[model samples]
Target: MSSTIDESAYVEASNGQACLAFKDEKQEARFELGVSMMVYKWDALSIAVENGWGGPESAEKRDWVTAVIVDLFKSEKIVDVTLIEETLLYAMADEFDTNVEDDSALPIAAGIVEIYKQCDAQDFSTVEKLYLEWTEKQKNKEGKRIVQVEEDPLNPDASESEEEEEDVEFEIEDSMAVDEMTENNTEPVVDEDGFELVQKKGRRRNN
Candidate 1:
C-alpha cells in the first residue's frame, strides 16, 4: 500500500507531525466508506455488537467506532497498523468493557491500509465489492448468526436443579432477599457461588 500523501499539505514541524490532507474530497469520502465496510467485517466487533456487549446501543457504538477510525485517518499524516490496532483495542475497552487480548485487529488494520491505497488510486472496485457483500449479508443475516449455548443433555435432573437455583436467585434479587431475611429473623444461608441458598422446590434435603 502506498503511504505517500499530498506533498503540498506535508509540512515539517518541531513536533515532527505532518498535516496530511486528501488529494480530493470525493476520494476521501470513498475511502471513509471503505473503512466503514471493513469495520463491519471485523469478527471481534461483530460478536460484541451482535451480543449487545456494548449495551442497548451496541449498533450505534459500532458506528461511532467506525467514525473514530475514519477521523483518525483524516487527521493524522501516517496511520499505521499499530496505531489502528491500538485505536480498536481502546474503543472496545471503553465502549463495551471488552478487552480484546487477541491480535485480531492487525488484519483489519492491514485491510484498511489496502483500502486506503486503492481509494487513493481512484479504484473503487474493492469498496464496491465490500458494499455489495455487506448489503447481501444484511439481507440474509448470514454471518451475524449467534449460536446459543445449551446445557448438557444427559443430565436432566442437573438441568432442573440449575433452573431452580436460577429462579431462586432471581426471586431473591427481585424481592430483596437480604431485607426479607432480616425481617423474618432467619439466618442468611449462602452457597459457594455467593448466592443465597434457597431450597429447591419438590426436592428434599438430607438432614
Candidate 2:
C-alpha cells in the first residue's frame, strides 16, 4: 500500500530547523497513522491479562509475554496467526477493563488461542511462529519436534566392506592357531616305576 502523505504537504520549518506541516490541515498525523494501521484491534496488555498465565498481573507480565511472542517469530520469515488460531475463532472474549474482574477465569488456554487469532502477519513472522509452537509444545508436553530416526537400508545385513573381510580372515587365523595348539600339545608324564624311589631297606643290615 502506498503512503497517504501528499507530496506538497511537507515543508521546511523556519530557518530550516526541521520540516513543518505544509498543509495546516489535520491530515498529516492521520495520514501517518493510516499508513501504519493498528495490526491488532485489541490492546496487547489486555490480551496478556486474559490469555497469559498472569491475569491481574498483566501490566507487569505484558513485556515478558510480548518478548516470548517476539522470540517465537523472530526466526521466521513470515507467520500466519490466523491459520494457527483459526480453530479458536469464537474463543476471543470481548476486550474488557483490566480492573473489572480479578478472577474472571477466562479459559486461559482458549483465551490464548483467541489472542493468537488477533495476531496479524506483520506482528509475527515465520520464525516467531515456529518458536511459539515450540514453546507451546514444551508447556503442553506435546511441543517437541519428533526426531525422525533414519531408516536402515534394505541391504543393511549385507556386508560389502573390506573390514568385514579382514575380520573373517582374523577369525580363521585364530581358529587355526587354537587348533594347532590343541593338536601339538602332548603332555609328558613320568612314571613312578621308571624312576623308582631309592630302596635302602637292607643296606643298614648289610652294613
Candidate 3:
C-alpha cells in the first residue's frame, strides 16, 4: 500500500485543528480541544514525518510514527482520559491511512513519544505563531456567520416561529398529562357472579 497519504483527506480549520477523513468518510482522529492542543498534535505529526516516518514496508518507521502520537497525548492534559487509547489508535490509523490493527499500533505509540521529546527540547515558536493566525481566521469566520444570520431576510419571523413552536409543545405536554390523569381515575366495570358487573353506558343504575 502507498504510504503517501492524500493531503485532501484532511480538512484544516481556522481553529488550528484538522479533521482527518479516509476516502471521504470522516475519521475519529479529529482533535476536539483548544488551539494549543491542535498545535501540539499537528506539530508532533509533522516532525515525525519530517524525520522519515510512515514509509512503505518499513516497520521501524511505522512504529516510530505511532510512538510520536502516543507520547503527544500523554504529555498533554487531555480533557478525557478514558479516550486516550481510542484517540491514539485512531490518530495512528488516520496518519498511516490504514486499519487500526493493535499489533501495528505499539511502535507508532513509541514514535509519538520520541516526537514529543524532540518538540519539548526544540523551540516551537513557529507553531505558536501559526496557532494565533488560525484562531484569528476562525473568529472572522464566526463573525461573518453571525452577521449573515442577522441579515437574513427570509428568517425575519424566525423568533416568532420559535415562540409559536414552544407554545404548541407546552400545550401538548399539558394535554398529555391531563389525559394520563383521567385514564388513571377512570372506573372499570366488573362482572358479578361473585364477580363484579359491567357498567353499560346510558343504562339506568337500578337496571
The predictions' CA RMSDs to the true structure, in order, are 19.2, 39.4, 27.8
Off by over 4 Å in 1: 1-18, 21-23, 142-207
Q: Which candidate number has the best lDDT? A: 1
Candidate 1 deviation (Cα RMSD): 19.2
Span of 10 residues, lowest total lDDT, candidate 2? 196-205
lDDT of 3 at 91: 48
Query: Candidate 2 residues 1-207, lDDT tens each?
Result: 112322222111345433322132223222212111221222333343334324333333332332333333333333333322321222222222333233222222223322232232223232234334534543554212222233345645655563354344111111111122356593322123221111111211111
Query: lDDT of all the models against the reference?
Result: 0.63, 0.28, 0.33
What local lDDT does model 1 show for residue 99?
91
What candidate 2 gets wrong by more than 4 Å, as runs, is 1-56, 83-207
98: Cα error in model 3, Å: 17
Going through the candidates in order, what is the number of backbone clashes in each? 0, 8, 21
Q: If ranked by lDDT, best first, what sequence of candidates would result?
A: 1, 3, 2
Q: What lDDT does model 2 reach?
A: 0.28
Report the C-alpha lDDT of model 3 over 29-89, residue by residue, as the tens digit.
1111122233233434333333323443222333333334334443444212223335555
